[model samples]
Target: MSLGLRTLWGWTRRLFPWVLAAIVLGLVARQARMVEWAEVWVAVQSLAVSQLALAAALAALSYALYASFDLVGRHLTRARVSVGRSLGTAAISYAFNLNFGSLVGGLAMRLRLYTRWGLSAPTVGKIIAYSMVTNWLGYLWIAGAVLIWAPPRLSQEWLPGALVLRGAGVALVLAAAAYVVLCFVSRRRQLSLRGHSMELPSGPLALLQATLGGASWLLIAAIVWTLFAGRVDYPDVLGALLLAAVAGVLTHVPAGLGVLEAVFAASLASDRLPVTEVLAVVLVYRATYYLMPLVLALPAYGWSEVAARRRSARAQAVGDAPV
Candidate 1:
């Protein structure tokens, strides 16, 4: 990379969070005007306390599963951190990643925290890469299954035909399966793609990644399904959520704000679920699944960052003392 290009890339990295925030704010403002607040409120209120509690519990479990991915990272890097400590850090970073964008949340925060905790930059990078794979393995399988057998009621504008959807589904399933199969059969410890190579986790480790990943996706869909009060098919809800997730990532919208709503409305709305009800349910899901955790994560994340920096500084000072 040229010096000017490198400088430009650095500036873009630093400024990306702000850009994402601006986009989110603009999208929120536009969507806020179009939303039917009264209907959303009614839908929100229709949920009984017991149902809400159930949804919250599901959300908690889902978050726990995601946090456990930190263990995979720990194992991959052979980091000396304890399970409890790793889980705590992962929980905080995961919350930030969900609300903020991945740049500031998962990638940056994990890099910052793990390196402070004593891992090198390359180790942290590997951890992040492995966690990402573990995170998405299940989504691919779920997407494939749903697309092939139980795709949502998307309009022609959203999805053209079952054949195309099924083809895509097969591709997804094969891609996920191929990873597992290769990991199982390959005697080599590294996987190469293009000119880049990744150190492959052991076959059992790969299997664990698939299982935990699949469970995480299932738990997420279950939370949304619970919020939907079982009114919609579970597969349809999963499919729509998978679609929203993909859209959110592609659009680079923070937490897929507005994208999820648009995708869900397009995929789920029907005689059974009017557009308003669909919007309302998604709003509640966002609150329960996204906003609530972010509320709790911010303080801890800030405190940990400060504490980690201070600890590192003290250690550095001690090392540099007259000897």
Candidate 2:
């Protein structure tokens, strides 16, 4: 690309998050005007203590599953790092990614932590690529399964018919299957693009990736469903969650912020569960899953940074002292 084009692309990527946030907020504002705020508030407050505890527990499990992404990445790349450090890095990186934009926040955090732990830049990049592939692999698997078996009712204005949903589902499943086939077919187990090479994990690792990734998404969907206290069936909620998550990711908004709520509200709008209640559930889920992790991760990350600096300074002083 030309220099001017590159600069423009950079600027576009930076501003896109804010633009998406504005669009999501506008849609949400319109939806908000349709519902009574009091009812939403009452519904949120009505959540039982046991329900809240269960949601919290599910949130913990969901993040633990996320941490496994790094474990898989490390194993694939053969990067050496302590288990505790790897888990911490994954948790903190994801926490930031969930709040800030993934490209800017999550990648930066992972690069820093992984580098500090002695991994080279290239290895970190590969780990990132592997993690992303693993994550999306799971998404496609779950999304395809949901659409094929228990497709939810989409807005007529958006999707014209059930055939389109089924076709899309088939395409997603095929895409995932293609990747698996590629992993097995390639003797070298590597792919090169634009002068950069990427090594695919073993077939066994790929299978594990699909299993773990799918399980993580299932756990996350369960977290959202638990908040509903069985108001909606698991299949419907899983379908909607996958759709909303995909939409959020495509928007490139930080943590998908308002975009997730808007898509989720639109997807689940019905007489049995109004948009307002759905929005309320989404807000609580975001707090428990997204914001809470960021809150804990920031402090833990900060402490690690400070401790590292202190240790470095002491080593330098010791080295410089006369014997």
Q: Native-vs-model 2 lDDT?
A: 0.84
**lDDT by residue (tens digit), candidate 2, 1-323:** 99999999999998988776566567756765677778878888988888889999999988888888888778877899988898888888988888887875568999998898889988888888888888899998789888888887876743447777888889989888888888878898778989999888777778888888899899999988999989999998898889778667766667877777777787786898988789889889999998888889989999989988898899899999999
In model 1, where do residues sit more than 4 Å from their true spots?
Answer: 1-35, 193-196, 309-323
TM-score for model 1? 0.85
Residue by residue across 1-323, what tens digits does model 1's lDDT show?
A: 99999999999998987766565445545656776778878877887787779989999888899999878878867887788877877888898898999998889888877776778887887778888999999788878988899866776755668889999999999998988888888889787777766778877888889999989988898988988888998988898899888768866878888888887877888887887888888888899989999888889878887887798899899999999
Which one is best on TM-score? 2
Evaluated at residue 125, the lDDT of candidate 2 is: 88
Cα error, residue 86 of model 1, in Å, equals 1.6
lDDT of each: 0.83, 0.84
Model 2 steric clash pairs:
none
